[model samples]
Target chain A: MTKLFIPLDSFAVACGADTIAEEFKRLVADRKLSIEIVRNGSRGMAWLEPMIEVETPDGRIAYGPIEPGEAETLVDAGVLSGAGHEKRIGKVEEHPFFRAQTRHTFKRCGITDPLSLDDYKAHGGLKGLERAIGIGAETVIAEVTDSGLRGRGGAGFPTGIKWKTVAEAKGARKYIVANADEGDSGTFADRMIMEGDPYCLIEGMAIAGVATGATKGYIYLRSEYPVAIDVMREAISRAHQAGVLGASVLGSAHVFDIEVRVGAGAYVCGEETSLLDSLEGKRGQVRFKPPLPAIQGLFGMPTVINNVITLASTPEILSAGAAAYKDMGMGRSRGTIPIQLGGNVRHGGLFEAPFGMTLGEIVNEIGGGTASGRPVRAVQVGGPLGAYFPVSLFDTPFDYEAFAAKDGLIGHAGIVVFDDTVDMMAQAKFAFEFCAIESCGKCTPCRVGAVRGYETVKKIIDGEHPAENLVLVEDLCNTMKFGSLCALGGFTPYPVMSAIRHFPEDFHGEPMRVAAE
Target chain B: MVFQARYDEAEAAEIIGEHRHLEGPLLPILHGIQERFGHVSEEAVRQVAAALNLTRAEVHGVVTFYHDFRKAPAGRHVLKVCRAEACQAAGGDAIAGAIETALGVKFGETTPDGQVTLEAVYCLGLCATAPSAMLDRRIVGRLSEAKIGALVEEARL
Candidate 1:
């Protein structure tokens, strides 16, 4: 029987995919259709989610953005036979969005049954772990180091260096913690990985355990992603049962086990140190560094804390030789980066491309311009902590150093677009308000300066001595940038300063000034 | 008006006992208590503190630090509207305004009848399908004024 697929991932579910899937299933059952229904993960082309795929003789035929009401029309069109239909988007692999991506980490995401270990292995799943075990721990670290894999968790730190630190640190027990607290507004790659191919994350962590001699691992996931949490919990239990995890992983002498810890609603907990604190059942506050997480972390033991993307990408680096992975990207950003296009974009989804793709190419060409069909005004690359870039800077390539050189960051590679109607001054103000709301309150500059910065921005918006207020806002941003303990306060200036500098027009027109005059 | 619910020590103990064996049990225990009791009460905090061999202040600090944990029971239905940039780009601001007007309350405020509570969440990771909201635990995306109204009506029942 031909297999019919529907996405049960949260993104698809949000678009009422569950209802559509149920209706489709019911319709098929009523019609006595011999098609077998399979609930799969999203294809990352979220614009066409609830995308149904049929295993045709040729390939997987794709149709999408299906609603519950469209079930009857789909049946009438005989979609099971892969016949022509209005929603049919041709072969799944032939779609421009999927075709353009150099998907290494996300290869198995939308392909295999997420819960099936056999499917995972068939699709080149545990090859990395098997390779790592044969090569031994030192060789695994060497391969990662030679591959030049930097932390995909916005910081861009070298992954090999971090593992080496934990390996060398004198501790009886070390821990590998995956930071799954994906609180970034425009980013959801981590959630997708955990939900789509959870086994990959498990294998990656197990490999880390082998390399660092850390026996235990923890994936600190945010509470917002209930689907990811459930998927990961189930995947971890299955891994343990299958000997892929717990006491001799993959039949090796190395023993490694993983636990899924849920974070309460704290965005700062996404920060490595704060995540450790939250994992320890304390307030999600930033801790002073110097005894950085590598040396002193997680109950004062040496820790290997990396982002979800960083860990998930580990298996690929191990399985494929370091040189093969290194040959893909330009400059220092070696390997593929999953660029999340979101906000007002026409074709918003996850695009995993090699580095050096300019912002203009991503926003205009691949993204298909604004979703509202309006003139694109500004785009915020990275998370809330990233700078807002105008159309003039669209030529900036997707590289960590390149963005930093332009006073911007390719943080997590999340691009949130804005149209002509957006108010940059308001966006600047929201940055401060967001900081004020989510501040850990451990430091003075972030906790108090953010509140002051909000008031100053408000004054500027009100045109209350616009020139002076603007200067004061600048000074406050500097103080927060320099004095803040963590990235929460340090990077808030990216949005605030970039807005004031690039879009000064929005900060004008104060009714209060006119009234005073 | 603020709505408060009394905490049960027995219930708190049961919740704590369920998660106390985990490596770091405090977060799990707190989450359990909040999930079961609808909020972490002062009495529940004291009970958890006693059970975990910690101070009530520490427990209270943790409860108040995270935005997810509520101090009192929410309305029967919790409506979380996305106010992040992605949603805003999709006219979420206007949708939020219409919701406030229709519900006769601002964000974080529950209806006087205690049927619905409106809250503002940063992002629900549904940027591709912009203008999303979560009613209770279910995500509703690509919302419009009429759809939100229907959702509110259904939530009230």
Candidate 2:
């Protein structure tokens, strides 16, 4: 039997499409037409939704944003026989937006129904888990290590090293924790993962459990992303039903499970230790890490804590083999980055690409420049803590070493673009005050220095004793950077310093408008 | 820190007990207590501390640590204006000024009428709809100073 597959893509309008695909299926059954109807995730070319893609020798033909009323015409027009609307985007793969992405983690995103297991399998979803299940723990760790996949949650720490630490640690009660607290300014990759490909994260966590000997896993989510939390929980529950997460997963010796924990409203909980602190029924505070979470974490047990992106990248690395994952990026920053272009950018969304792409390329070529159409003046990489880059250094590559070489860190791959209209002083102050508000207050330098830094920056902007406050502010940042307990306090200097370095004129204000130092 | 005037031990216990068995239930418990009693009571924190076998300092550390978990109750409505770079680029300062002028209260302070509490939300992920303000968890995007008052008023806090 020569079979045909027709995918009806519409979520909000699914009730209508349901009737149509059903009729199409009924019509097929009645006419003895060999056809398969599948409900898939939106192609994101939302204008052309309720789209039906029918397979044939030529390629899949597209007909979309179709009303139930138009379903019959589409079918009559032989949409099932590789026919489509004249206005169709044509081949899904040929579409520029879909083609632009180097989608490793999000390969199947927007292509399959987020809720359907059968559709997910049809798209090569659990093959990674099935492949990973057969591999030994050491081999799994080696492949990930070779992949050089780093934590995409701001800090580019080697994910394989983190997993290896827990895998090597002696513990019967180990835990794998995924931080879905994407509270950063211009980041949604984590939220997108939870919404679009939640099963990927579940599979990654389960794979981490199999690798690290962790039986229990938990995803700590910030309350801001209520949708992700709901979707992730549902995915996790379904995993349990499918025997993908529960004891002896996929009928193997590996036993794993996950539960979702909601953060009431804490951004600091996105930090791993703070997340564990919140997980342990305490306030979200950073712990002084000598023992590290891998050795002793989350109930004082050995834990493999990784950001959502870090874990999500793992299943693909293990499944595709390290060479395939590693072959993409430059130098030590292997594997593709799912950079989230947020803020004033025109085409802001998740763009997965190789590491060597320049800031200018990402902002201009992929991002289509600032949404306001003004000259792109500055960009803050990572999150609030990342430094602002001036137009002078737009050639900087998207990598840990590259960003660090330019005195910045790819903290979570969150790139916030700004047009010429932004004031540097205010954004600089937010970094300091963010540190102040979210500080654990365990260290005097961060607790005291952050407030001091905020005030000094305010003084600089006010232009009262400008030179003195500028000196004092730099001094405060230096103290906090060097003396603080963790990155929260340490990295606040990146933005403040860069704003001063790049946009010194903004801090100086009009020279005539300035007061005495 | 003054003890909350409306702190009820039984109610707080009921709230804490509800999510006690949940995984990492601290945040939900804290949220529940804050929701019921107008603020997180010392008694409740102590109860959490005791229930979880954690030190009061640890519970306090967690409470004082995150910007979201309040040691005290929030105002009837939360008006969170985006203060991140994306919003700023799209004119967040003007919106903030208008809100400050309208509410007669600065960021983090609740208006005396208990109508609204103005806070800074770093990013609402509605950057495409920049210059956004979240009115008590409901995201309102593509905002301006002129539009903020009506949006704030619509919340009826």
Candidate 3:
């Protein structure tokens, strides 16, 4: 039977891919067509979603943004033979969006069947785990250290160093926790990975388990991502059944089993300590550090906590060799980063590239500017905690250090674009509001200061002694920056301060004040 | 009208018992209770606290800390509108006003007729097609006034 590929991923389903899939199935059954439908993950070019691929002699031909009603038209136009039609976008590989990406971590995402173990292995999967098991624990740590891989989750700390700490820390039962509480706005790379190639995560976590001698692991996922939770649970069960997980992994002496823990809609749970708290069936609040999670974590044992991307990226680093992974990018940010282009961008999706590209190249070149066809005003790199950059800073390269130099962050590499119509002051206010709502109420600066910050921003917006309120807002931000225990309150200043500095005009006047007005 | 099931102590105990063996079972137990009953009642919290050997305050604190947990039953349909940066950049602020006006209910308020409960969420990760909303558990993206109106009407029916 001829293979027909369609994405059953959440993004595709949200964009009506399910309806299209159903329509295709109906057509196949009614017409007695010799075609088998394979559900795949999204290609990350979300604009072209409901993207259908037909395996032909010329390779997989692409057609997309297809509706259920268009199935008949596609069939009539001989889509089965890769015949050209208005909807046909030619070979999938040649598409500029796909061509531009240097997909390392997401290599098998759109190409292979997500849940199929055979499909995963066929596309160079488990090779890393196989190699890792052969090299043993000490060598695996050394290889990771040599690769200079840093945590992809916000803080860019050296991943090898963290693993070494957890490896050496004494405990009867050490734990490896995969922080999947991805609450950041303009970010979905983690979600995509979990839903796409879950085995890679399992493989990555397994490598950590073997390297660190941890027998158990837990994935602390957010409740918002119901689909991810379901997919991961299924994937873990499959892995256990296939002997890739549980006792005697891959028929080796090592044993590692994983559990899925769901967070109850707390963004603060994304923080390492807070995640641990939530994992332990308590309130998702930040814990005071000095006895950092590496040394003493999760049930008072040494635990290795790494973000989803950081863990998912490990298999390739091991299989491809450290030097090969190290040679890809500029500066300290080695290896490819999956940049999620979102918000008002014309071509918003997940774009994986090495870290040297400038923001202007990403927003204007890759993203094709704003979807509204308006002039780009500002872009918020990272999540809500990241600073909003005016178009003037678009020349900044997509590096962690480079972004930090400008008081910005590359947190999760989620870039949210805004057109000229945006009001920076309102964006600033929302940051404070988000912090206040999501704060775990563990520390006064984040808990109380955020509320004060929100009120201060409102005062400025109300034009109540605008200059005085601005100063007050600055003071409150400084307190929160210095006093908050975690990034929740600390980095809330990035958006607030950046807005006041870059777009003073918006704060100087009444609410909804535009630059032109 | 909104469906409100009276909290059953026996049912809560069974749900709690099912998850008690897990490493950290309180969250799963609480989630299970909420899932079955639509909301976690004060009585359920008391029972959970007793079973877990924790204070009532501790259980209450956990429930209130997270946004997903509800203290009371929601309307027939819960409509969560995205109010994050991505949605805001795509006219989400304006859409918020439009939705509130159309439904005659503000964010976090249930409609008087109990057909819809409006809530504001940070992001739905549907940034590519911004101005997204979740009606029940289904995400609808690239929203407009007409589309939201149709969704509200469908929910009402």
Give each model's clash number. 0, 7, 0
Write candidate 3's Cα lDDT for A1-517 as tens digits. Answer: 8899988776777777778889999999999999999988888988788789999988999898786588888998999879988889888779898899899999999899889999999999999999999999999999999888899889999999999999999999989999998888999999889988899999999999989999999999887776788889999999999999999989999999999998888889999999998899899889999798989999989999999999999999999999988998899999889999888899988999988899999999999999999999999999999999999999999999999998899999999999999988888889999999999998999999999999988887787888778878888888999999999999999999888877777887423222231
Per residue, candidate 2 scores C-alpha lDDT tens digits across A244-297 of: 889888899998989888776666778889889888877666888878999999
| Worst 10 contiguous positions by lDDT, candidate 3 chain A | A508-517
Tens digit per residue, CA lDDT, model 1, A241-329: 99999888899999898999999879899999999999999999999998899999998999999999999999998998898889988
Judge the docking of candidate 3 as incorrect, acceptable, medium or high. medium
Compute each candidate's TM-score over C-alphas: 0.97, 0.84, 0.97
Q: Higher-lDDT candidate among 1 and 2?
A: 1
Off by over 4 Å in 2: A1-93, A509-517, B1-14, B22-24, B34-39, B46-61, B71-76, B99-105, B111-113, B144-150
Interface RMSD of each: 0.9, 4.9, 1.0
For all the predictions, what are the DockQ values? 0.76, 0.32, 0.76
Question: In model 1, what is chain B's TM-score?
Answer: 0.93
Query: What does the lDDT read for residue A267 in candidate 2?
Result: 69
Off by over 4 Å in 1: A509-517, B1-6
| Model 3 residue pairs with clashes | none
When summed lDDT is taken over every stretch of 10 residues in candidate 1 chain B, the lowest stretch is B1-10
Candidate 1, TM-score vs. the true structure? Answer: 0.97
Minimal lDDT window, size 10, model 1 chain A: A508-517
